[model samples]
Structures are given as C-alpha cells and as structure tokens.
Target: MTLSQPTDAMHRKGTIISVCRIGLHDIPEVLSCGLQDFLEKPSHYFFALLIYPVIGLALFLWASQGNAWHLIYPLLAGFALLGPVAALGLYEISRRRELGLEIEWQHWFSALRSPAFPTIGMLALWLLVLFFAWLLTAEWLYLSLFGSSSAPSGPLALLADVIGTGRGWRLLILGHLIGFCFALTALGTTVVAFPLLLDQHVSLRTAVAVSLLATLKNPLPVLGWGVCVALILILGSLPALAGLIVALPVLGHTTWHLYRRLVRIDGSVAIDPKG
Candidate 1:
C-alpha cells in the first residue's frame, strides 16, 4: 500500500502498537455486537447498502457494453477488494460508539476525511490494483481457455463457452482457484486496516503490517471471520441483492469490533508496541 501521509497528529503519537491474543469465541462476540450496532441504527447502514445498487448498475452497464461478459465475474468478485473502503463510514460510527460520543450522523460523512485518510487511501489503491489485476487475469484466462480467435455473440454465448463442456469445467475450476488466491490476499491485507487507521494515527505501512501480523497471531479466528464475511456476502448477494442492505453493514460494524478485539496496543501510546 502507498500512503502519501499520516495526519499531523500522527506525529505527536500517544498510543503504542502491539498485537493482541484473540480466540474463536471472540468472533461470535464481536459479531453479536456488530449486529447490535446495526440493530440500533439500521437506517444509517441501510443507506450504506444503497451504494451496492449503484455498483451493481455500473458492473451491469460495463458488461453490457462489450462481448466480455466473462469479465463480470471478476468484477463482481473484486467488489470485495473495495469492501473496506466502502465501510469507512461504518468504522467511524463504531469509533464514535466506542468513545461514547454523541454518534452524530455527521460522523458518516466526516469519515470520508477520516484521521488516517491518506493511509487508508493508499491501502485502497493497493486493493484497486489487485482488483484490476484480477480482471486482467480473468480476461487472459477466458481468452486462453476459449481462444482469442473465437468470438461469442453475447453474454449467453460466453456463458455456454465457459459452462458447456469439459474445457469450460476446467476454466471454471482454475478461474475460481486463481480468484480465491486474490480474495484471500485481500482478506488478510485489509481485514483490520480500516478500523486500525480509524482508531489510531499509525502510518499506512504500520497499519497494514499490523493487520497481516494480527491475522498471523490469530489465524484460525481471523480466517474463520474471513470465511464468515465471505459466506454472508456471497449468500446475501442473492435474492435481488437486497440482503447486502443488512449483511454489509452488520459485517462492517462487526469488523470494527473485530479490529478492536484484535489490536490490543496502539503505537501512539507511551509504552512501545510490539512488532
């Protein structure tokens, strides 16, 4: 990730950065609190979900404009890479709640300029690179498997080529396999960066490194939480994409709590934080 700068206050640090011990049970606990947050201000999160329709529309239009309907799969899947950025507001809300602040609606918009916005922005560009890389890789896979010489008339034609035969089956498995690797990297890199940046003044590198370190420190719990997020998002995307209205924010809020649960030390503190 490429961070232009941390906030001015980041230089006058007060917290120390250190890893925390996390257990499997903590997953459910944080999730419960996340759900509670959503339950309390469902409307705030509901508005957050509204962004998905716009994203869906953009994807739909992009796919429609070309013969590359196969590109849509990666585009949709890459949406997860962008998930952390989308939930920035939810992180602010959770931070406000943690500080026992007034929980003003203004926090939602203010989160756009979050204290560590530059760091998070760099982290975002990194994810976007991964996102487009997946798209390009998917395009290569489709072209290689189906041959560049062959041209499909439309989405249905492309669908048949990728699902209608043995070659198609191979493409499906290999494509998913490759895509899973991308998704897993995204999950690890960003699982905690947003909330960490929201809550502390650490630089982009420190925030991302800690996120990866936290996952290593608490592998099973982090992986399980990642799985839960993936499953919820995948299942929720069905049934007219309405489920994201609840699933996204609940996970967003839950993720902030998960960040709190995982990051026991902040580098801004007096005590030196662990690597």
Candidate 2:
C-alpha cells in the first residue's frame, strides 16, 4: 500500500506538469491575441497620447510661477509621476488583448485592476534611478562649466566667466559620454523588465537578471535600439517638446515589441522543480 501511495503521488505530479506545459505553449497565441486587440482599439491609443499633453500643460502652468531654472525640478518630477500612467496604458493594451476585446479608453480602468500596485512600484523605482542619473549628468555639466569653484556673485560675471572658458565644448562631450554609459548599462533590462514584472508574479531579481541576459545575448540589436531612443530624445527637445506627443508613444509601443521578442514565454524548463 505504501509503494502504491508513492506511485499515485508521482502520477498526480506528472498530470500537473502536463497541464503547465499546455499553458506555457499557449503564451505565444496569447501574445498575438494581445497585439490584435491593441490594433483594433485606436481610441485607447488616442486617449493614452492625450493624457501626456494634459499633464504637460498642468506642469507648465505650475512652473510658470517660478524662475525658468526652477521649472526643471517640477518637470522632472512630473515625468517621474507619469511613468506609471504610461505603464497603465500599456497594461490596458495587454489586458484587453488577453480578453480578446477591442481597445478603448473605457478599458483604461480595467487595465488598472490587475498588477496595478506592482506596476506603479516598479515604475517609481525606475524613475528614481533616472532622476539620479539626471542629477549626476547635471553635476558633471556644472563642474565642467564653472571649473569646480565658487561662482561669481553677479549673473553677468558668471556669464562672462563661462564665456571666457572653453568649458562648454568639454561639457558637451562629458555629458554625452555619461549618458551613453548609463544607456548601455540599462539597455537590455529596461526594455522588458517592467512589463515582465507586471505580467508575472516573479520576483524583481529574476526579471532583472533575465532582462540583462537578453541584452547581453543581443548586444547589437539592443545598442541599435538605444541609439534610436537617444535620437528621439534629442529630436523631441527641438520643437518645444511637441515631438514628445509622437515620440513617446512610438518608443513605448516599440519597447513592448522588443520585450515580446526577448522574453521566453514557454515554460519548457522547470522554473522550480519542487513545484
């Protein structure tokens, strides 16, 4: 009877494994279904794009009260706050696809239902990292400009000192170098890491590791994508941030595509043997 009990347990385990296998194989089809859902739902896309401008306008109004330089902090803070808002839109796209429903603005609240808190948390973390990166680059720029010393009291004098030194040229180079290094380090992981975190209940460490591996495995493609991202950022800054209306959404959708390409959805290998 004891031997038969062991055999029965093994049989039950095999059945569970088979069920999991079937679910894993279904992932590709699920992904396709999701894409189709998004394509069919143009209203949702429109609403997502609209939100950015509304938020931007509000920031502009708030910052109009302060000196021009004071506005930078609020601008950065606004963008950080909006990261989750953007992710919520992406989540709507993914969730509607899962339900085989057409995308619409109405789907926004629905998308916020699942993985909402986790998505917000991850976005907040990423934005904090981005803010620090900006600060580091800003400090580098300031030092490059002022030569690491106390500045003159008068605005005119400060301007004169800056103009007298050939530091502007060097600042440009140093800023670009720092930005490039930061991009490369974060290239692979950022593309898919957040979406994966939202989609799966897995720990952040696993998702980040998987993302890094994906980047290392396809360095050329990831680097190319990074260059494209940099170009878009530069271009978007040219027309008083008007370019962001189009640039941000395009990059966001493209990132979704990149993530789809990189992550292995098939749970063919046992993630946890004990399970």
Candidate 3:
C-alpha cells in the first residue's frame, strides 16, 4: 500500500476506532506499525536522522565562535534546514499507518504537500518559545551564580569564577527549578501535540489538552520518558552537540510512539468537553 492510495473505508474507520478505544494498550500495535514501516523504508528515517548531526555540527561550530549574534543565524538556518526533515520523518510514520504499508522513503516528501505554511509557521513558533525558555534558564543560572556581577572577561575566568564560588548548590537548585518549570509547560503538550497537529487538522487547544490529559493519566511513564529525554539532553550538551545526532532521532521516534500511545482519533471515546 502507498500513501497515495487510500485504504478500504471499513479498515480505515475500524483501525481508528480500535485505536481510540484501546488507548495505551494499543501502543504495542502502534509501535509494531512504526517499526515495520521503518524497517521497510529505512532511507527516509536515516536521512531525516542525518540532518541532526549536520545541524548539531553547525551549531557547535557557531557557538565556538563565542559571538552571541552569530549563534542566532545558524540556529535559524538549522531550524529551516532540519524542520522539514523532522516533519518528513513524522509524516512518513503517519502515512505508513494510514496506508497500511511498510514505510517508504518516497513518503518522506508527502508531508510537504500538507498545509505547509501553517505547519512551518507553527514549528517556527515552537522554536521561538524554546529559545526564550533556554535564554531565560541561562540568564537565571548566570544571575544565581554571579549575583549580578559584571561579565567575566574570559571563558576560563568565567569558569573559574563559577567554580570558585560556594554557590554550586544554589546554582543547581536554580537550574533544577528552571528545568522543572520548562518541563512541566513543555512536556505536557509535547507528547501528542505535534503529531496531533500533523496527523489531524485539529486546533492547537484540543491537541494541547489531549497531550496534557495523556500525561496526567500516565504520570509514571511520562516521567520516565521525561527522564530519558533529559538524560539525552545532558549527553548532547556534554559532547558539544555531537551527541545530538543520536539523541534527536531517538527522541523524535520515541515521541511519535508516545503520541500514538496517548491521543485518541477514531472518536470511539469521548473526551470531557469541559477538559
């Protein structure tokens, strides 16, 4: 089956209804679908994953320059370059399931035919929010450490200043708080929201609410997943972005699975309208 072709009406509706009814227990089936697709059409997934290293290298090299503004251009460029790849990865997964076919590299471009402008616009908005969150967290950490002191003249000096102070515990607490807040706001919506947006023409409010409800319903799994993601992030930072090549792809794939486990689509079950 190909994405360009439609499944039988009965099968299409039935699959969706079953998925909506069984909910998280349907995760194994969903993952099986994704795995079959991935194994059959490895190229698209591989290529999509490849963009991570390219973007990571670009960011690392740019950051090495220590120029604040220089970082922005590469960041924007990386997003522009990688956003489509990430979207393609996601689209292939959805298209594979929709068509009941093994994933194919050909399907990678199918998402480009989706409502491109709105998708890209939403992605851009997401990036902006992420950037601000990072900026705020960094600023808070710096202030907590330096106590509003003047900027240190050199990287080595700055490191020395930060390390010399007995404020490591304080900085850790501040960083943890920032991370917790960011995680709460971001994770609640992240699991299903993006995939929901891509798979269905749903409003952001509905997607976000569904995502949050999913998290709240299965807090342990969600928290474990969060820990896994945080560990990946910490690893990515340690290698000066080299780790992102692995981390990003894993997170992207895992997140797709997370969405499959969480959101309902067949309308077999009714979400509380008040929620």
Leading candidate by TM-score? 1
Model 2: per-residue Cα lDDT over 44-130, one tens digit each: 566557666576666666545442332343354335323434655665465445445565566555535544456546755775676
Which of candidates 1 and 2 is the stronger one according to lDDT?
1
Candidate 2: stretches off by over 4 Å: 1-42, 45-47, 51-85, 94-100, 109-111, 147-165, 268-275
Flag the better candidate by TM-score, 1 or 3.
1
lDDT per residue, candidate 1, 1-275, as tens digits?
Answer: 11112211112255656667677878888899898887877776566578885777688677878666777767777787788888888887777776666665666766566557787788899999999999899889888888887867787887887778888898899998998899889888888888877676568877778778787777888889978888888887776567777888888899998887776653444311110
Task: Give the clash total for candidate 3.
Answer: 1
Pairwise TM-score winner, candidates 1 and 2: 1
Evaluate model 1: give its lDDT: 0.76
By the lDDT metric, which is better: model 1 or model 3? 1
lDDT of 3 by residue, 1-275 (tens): 11111121112323341112123334445445555545554555666667666766676566556533313322432232233236445544654555556555655555555554375457547646765656555665666566565555555655565567667456546655765666656666656666665666455565566667666666766666666666655676467556655555545555676565555456433322211
Off by over 4 Å in 3: 1-41, 67-88, 94-99, 116-120, 147-160, 236-240, 267-275
Local distance difference test scores for all models: 0.76, 0.51, 0.53
Report the number of the highest-lDDT candidate. Answer: 1
How good is model 3 by TM-score? Answer: 0.67
Report RMSD (Å) for each prediction in the order shown: 6.7, 10.6, 8.6
Candidate 3 to native Cα RMSD, angstroms: 8.6
| TM-score preference between candidates 2 and 3, better one | 3
Candidate closer to the true structure by lDDT (higher is better), 2 or 3: 3
Error of 1 at 96 (Å): 1.5
